[model samples]
Target: MPTAPCLQTILALVPRKRAFAASNCRHASLTGGTTIIQAGQIAWVRSACPAGSGPCIFRVLPLHRDGFSIPVTDTPAGNRGARRGSGGITLDDVARLAGVSAITVSRALNTPERVSPDTREKVRLAVEHTGYVPNLLAGGLASNRSRLVAALVPTIAGPVFLETIEALTDALARRGYQLMLGQSGYGESREDALIDAIVGRRPDGIVLTGIMRSEGGRRRLLASGIPVVETWDLTPTPVDMLVGFSHEQVGEVAARFLMDKGYRRPAVVTGDDHRAIQRRTGFERAFAERGIHGVPVFTVPAPTTLGSGREALRALRLAHPELDVLACSSDVLAHGAIVEAHAEGLSVPRDIAVMGFGDLAFARDAHPAITTVRIDGTGIGRQAAAFIADRAEGRAFGQKVVDIGFSLVERASA
Candidate 1:
């Protein structure tokens, strides 16, 4: 939401220093040192990382009063032949073991099409035998690109994000950027680690699943120059850019839908995540407008499974026996609620109406056909890709903040 500082302003803020900034830094991974402008990207030269490097990377801390910061390299002196960055296998070692040139190894790893099948197979076998990992930072340094983007999601096991991931993957691939995924789980600690790791890698862009809520995390993101896209939820004060819908709006519409259907004792089954809570707030506020109060919420862990859904229903049933409708934060939760209804000898929509968010692939296929709120996840994916690609390629585009929006999918369940 805050205006990002201009590049020149940022550059002016940090003073030029000859010495490395500090020692005993803890962060993840490496980005090649030395930067230049090319191909519409801020290309950088990647410095070498010897095996058993003392530290993986340096971080950009809060700007000092001097308006300058020093970035440090990771590799320690000596033992260069034994290890690379992160003390892992180096490409040179792989080339040596494979009886091929390092260039051939790079071609085999980065662009196998440029190498003969026989040579590719040889490099592949050598890679397998040596456990040699390609340092993408080196390649990025050489080519003046870390043609990578990182997407941080709560959990990869959930189906709600799969569509966006698939679409985003395809779209970015067409533009020559590889996707690096990180699972932030369900809390701040995970987010902190992921942020440090991601920014350290110097990814061209970062795509987050929801608005960053933690103060420390938000500050960290704002400090970096990388382009970011926050998806699945919206906020006027996004870290950089955003592509999502309003959770409160979904909740209000869903709650009203149930009320319009004449279901009075409606309860919500929600995952215990930030966005889910916002949707629940909207749901509660809308019901309050209709003179409804004390609407119960059964909360469960994130990446809600069918079992959790069923269990949530059972728990709610004990407390609110007269409940006739179940609204969920995700289709997966709704699906579980339907299964539990059958267990209670209740017929969906007849004995109980159900509504869910996220019109997942299986929503329509469910026995009672889930009625849910639908967001244009594919559209979000495509636009997010464009946002990153356009920025990385130095193309100007309007509207850094985008609300791809959502829809209501009415079905038999509701």
Candidate 2:
């Protein structure tokens, strides 16, 4: 008898229709020297016979979209049998283990809030057991959506942004989207690098902590056509949408509040961040309008801490003991100033009044309940999420810029 043809020769002889007739075929055992090619719900098998035995055979089999199994095939001496490598664990594996659909598994991972607690726990356990890592890039390419939003903040250590971040995360989860956070530091270079990395990933949306300051970063954002939301700072000309209050207005109001309370000799202890400087300028301008020019200012590095605040207050007192009131850039700094004043036996409000920005929790729980400027951080976060979701979902929205504004909270410290 003639030797059996090689696998490639047999494939060449078979017609494309017969080789790919997956619907007409039934499941069969695969023998030695068999190679399987899978495409969607179809599989093509090529089985080679021994020399002088019989002609090679080709078969098609229908398979579940999620998975399939192949038996180990023994090869003749000095001949390597064709084999398929295990493709690793996948979403379908987790779904099968959890007794749910693949889409349900995906929903549980991306938006657990949409699924019941029990179902979510099942999917979670399945994922944990199988070590299934979601291929977001593949899914995103197929569906044209990553269902992910990227957010950049100046610093994660600052308590002032905690409310906004929490609100953003909650709102996004409710809408079946996830948030990826990045720290842009307090410099242009770091922000620009982060923007570049974020843009390359092509997220559904981007949330920025402040208005884009770098010209290159602004240009990239405008060119990328991604929905952008600038938060915590205001600008008439934003790259896309904006939800923030004016830092200048916050400072001016703090200054006027002290002036109204009969604290005439007022000075400032502020961080050197961009927003802090803007507030300081506003404070000085307000006092300058009343011929009170040259207000004493003590500056600390960005991300001001309690130690810096204490040092600032001490230094300001030594230079201008007449300064009866002090305005601080953050509640952390103001809290320090209050502690230092008490340490020096100076009575709060009576001896040295102190005001702080970002009415954080410590401001309310302080010894004298610090007077401070209150910005609606949660409101900004929710509004920003809404803006990004609307744009991502192709909903028409008229508002591009929103000023959440700020308020003065007077307490015992002032």
Scored by lDDT, the top model is 2
List the lowest-lDDT window of 10 residues for candidate 2.
6-15
lDDT of 2 at 206: 99
373 Cα displacement, candidate 1 (Å): 1.1
Give the per-residue lDDT of model 2 (tens digit) for 1-414. 444332211111122233232221112232343354433222333433443433333322222222322221222222354322233456765777688898999889876888999999999877665557888899899878888999999899989998999999999988878999999988999999999999999999999998899999999999999999999999889999999999998888888888888888988998988999999999999989877888999999989899998999899999999989999999999999999999989999899999999999889999899999999999999999999999999999898999999889989999
Give Cα distance to truth, residue 318, candidate 1, Å. Answer: 2.6
For each candidate, what is the lDDT? 0.78, 0.80
lDDT (Cα, tens digit) per residue for candidate 1, span 212-311: 9888888888898889999988897999888999999989988888889888898989989999999999999999999999999998988788998899
Clashing pairs in 2: none
- Clashes per candidate (backbone, < 3 Å): 13, 0
Model 2: residues with Cα > 4 Å off, grouped in runs: 1-87, 92-133
